[model samples]
Target: MENKKALVFGSVLLSGILTFSLYGIGSSIASDDSKHEHDREYEYRDKGTNYSTKSVGTNKLYMEECGSCHMAYPAQLLPTQSWQKVMLGLEDHFGENAELDAESHNSIESYLVQSAARRKGESRKLLRNLGNKTPLRITELPYFIYEHDEIPCRFITGNDKVSSLSQCSACHQNAEKGRFDEDDVVIPGIGRWDD
Candidate 1:
């Protein structure tokens, strides 16, 4: 009778473990699906063909010039006034040494100013951090700093693909296409458990 009771107890314990493991797996899958749906909805609702390849003038300059090195700084990352400051300081761009032609410079400046961070709605974390203040340096961006806090300084400078800490998408999985959620982050050379 004792042996039979032990057998039943073991079976129940095993069943509980299996149930918990399956629940965890199911929850992870459901979370992934929700995130995917959110991204899809954001893309569909925020459509305006202009930010894409069809962008002209300064927008083109951003893609052709800036994008060559890193993801184009999202227009919503800075207030409109801040974008103006950055555009005006293009001659002294942080490190790339950008020197734009007058027409291209004006075009890019206009596009950036028009789509400045101020114009963005409250949905963006970057904009939220700005808090009505116009920031001059992209590095000053709160969201940028928060996202990069985990990255080691050596990796950022050592990696060829990543020149500055501002390049979030370089290591982050969904960064190339403009998704920076925590779930989307997959640090290279690190295991999921580490994350």
Candidate 2:
């Protein structure tokens, strides 16, 4: 009788464990389905494209030093080598005195190079295409120009608020967050860009 009781108890415990495991598997599948559905619904509602995915820099020194003058563009916009060159040429940063002290300079330099663009995925595939080049200006990069090919100079260089094409946030509402989706674009004088 004692052995029979032990067997019954073991069976009940195993049954419970199996049930919980199955439930967890089912829940994960349901969650993935929900995300797909949400994406489909968003595309149907939104008139523009998505940012897909982009990594934003989180270094405090990089923000304070680089951003103090111009918009602290995302470090991933450039490759590791490009960042190295930029940090090496601060005194003449695009024809400006962006020189920083050793400590601050080293910190910002490390951050930019470490957080530079990767070489894969939709967000970073462009980095791989930039073979044989280490462009200092993000605007001059072939991939960046291709991405902004639809927009004319009038909407960018011609606009007072956006003095040049380098001014990303001038139109990208979530540029700081690394999102440059087509739907989020809204030029100051003009409206949504669809091309």
Candidate 3:
């Protein structure tokens, strides 16, 4: 009977030690993750803005269809009129047949229209320098051009990893989240963008 009691006590003690060890490891891992997130936020804050937390929401159908070919840019990047034009010309979308079924097209159109950049809001900066022109391409927007004008062509077209400025994800790590802060840019072969 004494041996049985000793065995039981040993088992419980071993279990407690194992549980404590696992808990410590888990806590350490969680702390590391928190540190990483803090560092990322600090980097964005240091850049004079905090676009790192932006989230434009998401659409399943839109991501499945449009995102399959290219980055499904945040709808706020364009205006309602521009999205309408793009949807109307899906048969020749940027030199490709991107037409969708009526059901899919209508749904996607509604989503884009609802989230398009408004004349007054977070997207107003994207609409600047426009004098009643409907641009079908985000890259053609005056604000976009102005933001990228300083980047040399060689760093883009010449760099195999980044064929064009249209591929926002190629440089902007958080492009999918609607975060285009300058500090988030890291050109493929070159490095972090200083200019």
How high is each candidate's TM-score? 0.61, 0.70, 0.71
Residues 1-195 of candidate 2: C-alpha lDDT, one tens digit per residue:
999999999999999999999999999999998876555311111111322122122266677778888888877678889989998998998899999999888777776776667674333745646887989998878878888888888999899988788889999887876666677889999998887
- Any idea what lDDT model 2 has? 0.75
Q: Report the number of clashing residue pairs per model.
A: 2, 0, 0
User: Where is the poorest 10-residue window by lDDT in model 3?
Assistant: 42-51
- Model 3 per-residue lDDT tens digits across residues 113-174: 87788787568888899779999999999988988999999999999999998999999988
In what order do the candidates fall by lDDT, top score first? Answer: 3, 2, 1
Judged by TM-score, which candidate is best? 3
Measured with C-alpha atoms, the lDDT of residue 99 in candidate 2 is 92
RMSD of candidate 2 to the truth, in angstroms, is 9.7
Candidate 3 ranges beyond 4 A from true positions? 1-58
TM-score of 1: 0.61
Model 1 global lDDT (CA atoms, 0 to 1): 0.65
**Where does candidate 2 have its weakest 10-residue lDDT segment?**
41-50
